[model samples]
Target: MTSTRRRGLIDIEIDAQKEKVRKIKEDNRIFDTLETDKTTLDNEKKKWFFTRWFSPTSIDDLEKRIARKEQKIKEGLERTSIDKIHELEERIRILELAKTNRCENVVWMDVPEILDKKIQDDYLEKFRKLPQKIDEQVQSVNITMFGGVGVGKSSFLNTVVTALINNPQRIYRDYKTAPSTTGISKTKAFIPEEIRKKRGQSYREHPTFKDVMHCIVFVIPATTNLYDRDDEALNKIRNLQQRINGPRDVKQVAIVTNIDRIGVPNVDMESVFKYPNVKEFCEDVSKVLEIEIQSVYPIANYHEEQKPTAAKNALALMALWDMFKCGERHIKKKLEIGLNDDQ
Candidate 1:
């Protein structure tokens, strides 16, 4: 009957939607684990069957067991539609917008507050609790970059780091580029299989894969032409994204860089949308990468100087916010927190 009652009802619906999204995320995660395990089991069975065809006393038995496991995984996957997860996400966004009395894409002005230590500490604590090392995948928020070497991945990453720490030089601390003096051989005697990579390292690099990174940044130039090796590298990243977060769910932002060089350098750096060519490039890159166009951003990083500009700083904040939002959704899904949970 009252406004308070209406607000309370909306909050209740929001909580319900959050729970639904969380559950669906867990179901899809289980499905991913099943797929990974089945693949590995299949490979092991094949290796034994092929290598020890005459020596095996139980080759057929192993094959039968793997087939049974694969069937179970397939059934589990079929029971849960991936579309449900997308629906839940949209519903949650709508619900949150209604409750907050805000429009979609409400650019919060509290960047300094968000950069505060308390919020980050709280996030890191919860992120640590997210289930890790699921078969071959790390449960951290991943950002996969797909582009050439000179595409300004380092510069863009530096800008992001500068904004996060409120210090401009943070990006330079660990930033070192490894160059190949002798160019990569396309026609080598043996082109080794491209080794799989993820957010965290194995036992050699890290003791554990928990809360190591709140974000994973993958850099790729926007100039990667279609059907080229750079394009092929982009596909490798696409596959990695699918492998880590499944076909339907991955928090990815394609940082389409070199807008400064693509067209005449706009002295007005914030005028990214002002140029029709820039907008077209953004669309084209997203289409090629098979990601949402909204996830594609045009950025120009500090090449000659380390100082931040108002326009460039705004873009950096935006990119970081996008990445953080991805991390937040991922943390919620992976942790499976309830309304009463401390997170």
Candidate 2:
């Protein structure tokens, strides 16, 4: 067989896999909607005695509808196994890796150069004033990033600090701390299990929002293969996620870094979202980390560039904005819970 023919066959398989994944996602959405409607109907039926007496037939019809929806949901669940999706996705990944530039632009993000400065200034301004607006009990917001070694964790923090400063010449030498003025404090590096365990114990006992992480960011490289990294590292990350976000109610986001390493022709930092593989990579990370796709942000750090470009800065700043919002929401939730308890 000719090489060209084999390549053509692989391309067809990749397309088929992608289509299968899409259909499964659509089916899952329908199942979710059906489940939601069924729950609402069930609640309506359980409401007041007036509802049942005045409209017995209506209630009976609603119950019948709920039963049908439940059956449909059960059928959908049987058909759509999470393991099946993972298998198909793995096949797609293998096929994609076999060919260069196998994926096209599957997603889009508006990144006009004219709007770059506006986005930068808007987020920067918000960060500048956020410290003042935050509740005094919270003191300051902390964002802790957890990932394997060399996943661009420090580089991402550096890029964010540089972009928030909006200065090309201004150098941020320290990777450990983001400036206090930014109203954000980033952990120096990946925390060891012992240190994290100590902190976890302290948090459980004290239960104070102060000096605790409000936002947890998981940095995963786009080029990282699931099988390549150490299993211990990956397991540690998952354990951390369950421990921190599970009990603490801290908002979580996954930052997919090193997107430029992905096979995209003439790819720029701003154009990361334009590549199908980048989006897939984000999806892969999301599935691996159990994070929502929307919460996953893909970015290229300032590695080679001597100075930051607006596109790069804008991308970094966009992720920062998300992290900021997540942190703020965590703080507000704690305050609201405290207020409710007081009442």
Q: TM-score of every model?
A: 0.45, 0.60
Model 1 residue runs over 4 Å out of place are 1-147, 165-218, 227-230, 245-248, 264-266, 337-343
Output the worst ten-in-a-row residue range by lDDT, candidate 1.
183-192
Ten consecutive residues with minimal summed lDDT in candidate 2?
Answer: 264-273
Point to the candidate with the largest lDDT: 2
Q: Give the runs in model 2 whose Cα sits over 4 Å from its true position.
A: 1-105, 108-115, 129-133, 170-186, 196-207, 227-230, 264-267, 339-343
Global local distance difference test of model 1: 0.52
Scored by TM-score, the top model is 2
